[model samples]
Target: MKLRVENFGPISYADVEIKPLTVLIGKNNAGKSMLAQLIFTLMTLTEGYIPRRFLTSMLQHIRTTEDFIAPYLRQVDDLRKKIKEAREITHLSCVKMVVDMIIEYLTQYLNKTLGDFLERYFAMELKSLVNLYSDYTRVECAYSKYSIAEFTITKDGNLSAKFDIKMMDELIDNILKDEETNKLINRVIRSRGGRDFTSTIAAIEKIAEFIFPKRPLLSTLYIPAGRAGLLEGYEAVSSALIALASTAPLKGISVPPIPGMAYEFYSLLLQLTGRKGPFEKMSDLFKEVIEGEIVFEELKLPKSKMVYRFKFKDKESSVDLIHAASMVKELSPIYLVLRELVDKGYLLIIEEPESHLHPAAQVKLMEIFAQLVNEGLEILITTHSDILLRKLAHLVMEGLTGGRANANLKPEDVAVYLLKPDEKGYVTREVNILEEMPTFDEVIEQLYEEERNLCYLSLQREMNEASPRNF
Candidate 1:
């Protein structure tokens, strides 16, 4: 996929073709993080599954046919009364006739309802994108399959949206069919029989899935730069918030709003510290770099309050995660995700993996990243570490010669962008990789010039000391 950003944040213009392994290198505050967050938000808003709350709310309140079919049946009052009366019948042939009539009347209603829901869903997503990037007056994003969604905010603070509904209508017809609608009708009928509604809920869930397919390939996880600080205070702060929230209903206290990004990060931390999944085996590279495993412990209180603590486990002993080495805390979240959350074909956006890590450890981490890419995991990283870039260069070289073990990464698989700010605004330029190495010669040339100037100054000083003074 290609992402083009103009007049967003510090970026005046940038058009990047995302690769399997994309790297962004620049000085701090050069708009790299802004670009990454924008991509994450767009991918998530467009391709993610339907919101669980929206689906559950629709199912709970709109259970009976009367709930959604009422408007359509308002004029046909006698027919509606007859349909309600037919619900009490027991004979098979009579019931089938009533069901067939109801289905015939509800076909157009169901199609309209589903179509309106989809339009509103896409509209809501576009509004959210506008709110997230409010500074930019104009923004545009287009997916490979979906049409372009554009937004403009005028000087009067009025927002306008231009979106095409033609593709969405076609998608609805292909994924949601009349057969599924019939199944929904049957499930609703069964729900009215005093039987458990599990099957009905399941049927609704399937319909929702087809309408909003899960993002199989573009599944993403963002590991922010503030992870260390967040990890340190996660337990205490989260417990306090939970306790307060739990008592708010009883005490009549108002609950304040939490930042969305903070909430997402906290949720990720909780998942990491919650349970063990199928992928419990840590890879050899992770073991070599971390030298330990993550362990979660549960604590029970008198009032049925349960608190969880995260720790590190080695061959000798276990220690609290907060007190463990900085590198451990920095890398634990990533390890937990790869071990438990992700299986294959995921996009991982990491701000800086080399944070608080030794130079050697940083190189090792890049090697592991290469291995992950070979195993079908796409990565997007923003870094200022020359060491990490050099390590990647060496890996590319090794891959070229076929001398590296399990080194499936080639020069074509990687894309590097150098971000810098000029008088106009920030710009992103794709750096060329020649002979299996990145062209960072500009940086090297600057260093060489500085050294040469110092040498010239030293020689001039020595000559003055040997010569006689003119005073």
Candidate 2:
């Protein structure tokens, strides 16, 4: 997918092409996080799975006049009584003609009403996709295309329908005449099928789902850098609250709203504490790399309430996640999500995965990420760690050489963007990777120059010491 952002936060303009394993490396406050957040927000809003109940409710409200045939018949009966009192009509044929005219008029009106309702509904739904952008920034994301339904009333008093899929219009032209259209519309509106409502709705829903099936909603799990600090205090605060509540029954203690990044971290923490799933391989991998496994314990509180505490367990003992090594606390969220929440084809964004970890651990984490990418997980990371970058490049080379088991990520599979600031705000450029290695000559050269300067200073100091002092 390609994401284009203009005037968003610190970024003036950036057009980024996202690959399976995307890396953004730059200095602090360089708008790397801004781009990551933009991708997350867009995917969350546009491609997230919508509840079936919401769709059903919207469908139910789309009613046609034929669904209210009894009311129209009642109106006709009332009119007939009024006409009879005003003037006596001796001919039964004339009364039949008037009733037919009323029915025809009502059917036409209902068909137009149904058509209008469908047009407005479909248009409004399609319009919502464009509202993902903020006022200060313009964002566009291209993904799999889907069809939108269009309804039109033909000049011959018939209902016409079309499915606009990828600009290829599949027209069901003049599919229903006035009366037939009314009946069809009524069937759809009332959901009257299986000779009644249920089957009719089921069929309609099937068609709708086919044309606009849930767009492979990419589940984005973002592990923020502040998770360690949050995890430390979460246990103490929750335990204290539980203890206080046990003394006396508290009334109306509700969860306060957590804003911004805090909310994201809290939500992930909550998911971690909930039911654990079977991800033994991933759990074992975490243990192998981090030397510990995340263990959650359920505490039964008063009033039959249950709360959970996350802790790190080694071979010997279990420690509160807060007191565990900094690396363990920092990587706990990643382990928990991979073990329970994340699955194949989900997007996992981590901000500075190298935080609070040794260089060796950081490199090992990158190797794990490579394995994840090979196993169908899409990962995006923003980092300032050269260790992580070097590790990734080495993995690509190893994959190419067929040395790693089932790990094959090509250079093209990884996209590295370097974010930097110029005179005009911040801009991002894609870094070139040649022969399965990313080019970082400028950084390497700068490091060499610094080393050379240090060596020259040392030599000058030695020479001055060897010579006798002039004084």
Candidate 3:
């Protein structure tokens, strides 16, 4: 997937691609986090609950059946022939017509979907993110070769968006290729023989599979900055929200807006899942490196209240996560997510994984990230930590040098974006960051020269005092 933008936040223009191990790097306030959240919005878009539920339920039934598939495959050739005949007759396409109807129907709600995330995540009105100087802020999305949407947020906060139709008749055509599935599809089309309102919608719900079958939904989690603080207070925060909601109907109270990413982090923390996850090996690696583990336990209280504690590897007792070391507070969420929350193809969006760690811990964390990517988890991170970036480069080099070895990230799997400042504003461009690491040589040289001058001044003072000039 690729996202092109103009006049968004501090970003004057950007054309960033979303790769397996996508990275955003820039100075503070250069809009790296803003761009990261934008990508998250793309990954987690929804037409609405009804449509998603309808499609999910449809696919669940479709996925269970095995018969009628061969006949459906035969029908695909027929669909192609139909396309040729229909083009000659009406200059239209059955498959394209079906696909466009689906896209058009979904596109109606997509603007609100985008607006909801932008408004709630940033805790602002829709137009707040638009660059102050520009009248319009725009973003264009492409899922592989299929153009999804190009939306603009105007100065007055109106959202104007549209999408294009490429060759997606095959998507609908293929769904019609199965036998039992074909019967199910035929039932959906034929059973609604009346002109009632509910029947019309019911038909659309049943046919959702034909147009949007098996579109892989990207599961994404956004770990916001100041995660340590959020984790530290989430126990109390969650309790308070529950307490307020308990009497909200009587009191006519409304809960304040929590930042959407922080809300997601809290939800992840609160969820209690016992099914062992696939990333346990990598999680254990992290525990081995950090020399600690975060344990989760549930209470039988309201909402099945949850508690998380941190304990050292050699210790018998555990401490509440809030009372743990700052580094532990900062990083325990990573362990929790890998151990329970995410799986293969899940995206983990983290801002600055090296927040409180020292050099060794920071370097090992990068290695762990590389290992996770190798195992099929997608990571998008923004960091000012040059050490982490250098470690990433080293891992890429290791993978290349060791004949694409394990515990390293391949170049093709990683993309590095640099948000650079220009006269107009900040613009992000993908760079060959692994080939050459970013070295702040000029700044380092200046620092060393300043130290040398300080040393000279100290020596002169000592010599003058020893010569009795000061006495």
TM-score of each: 0.66, 0.65, 0.80
lDDT of 3 by residue, 1-471 (tens): 788999998999999887779889877898999999888776676323234444354557655233323322223333334444552422123334334555664565565467876786777787888988789899988754544677899988888777655556555455456454445434433433222323333334434544332233446778888878998778788878988977977898878778777887788777635445777767887786668887776756555755777878999888877999888888888887788767887889999998898989999898888888888888999998878888888888888888446677788999999888877678987778656544334356788999999999999888988996566
Lowest lDDT block of 10, candidate 2? 168-177
Identify the runs in model 3 with alpha carbons over 4 angstroms from their true place: 46-52, 58-92, 166-218, 252-254, 298-306, 439-442, 455-471
Computed on alpha carbons, the lDDT of every model, listed in order, comes to: 0.61, 0.58, 0.71
Candidate number with the higher lDDT (1 or 2)? 1
Query: Model 2, range 153-268, lDDT digits (tens) per residue?
Result: 33232453332334322311221223443343355334212244343333322333333334334367777776788777776655565566655445555544344455566666
Task: State, as a TM-score between 0 and 1, how close model 2 is to the true structure.
Answer: 0.65
lDDT of 1: 0.61
Cα error, candidate 2, residue 365 (Å):
0.8
Q: Pick the candidate with the highest lDDT.
A: 3
* Higher-lDDT candidate of 2 and 3: 3
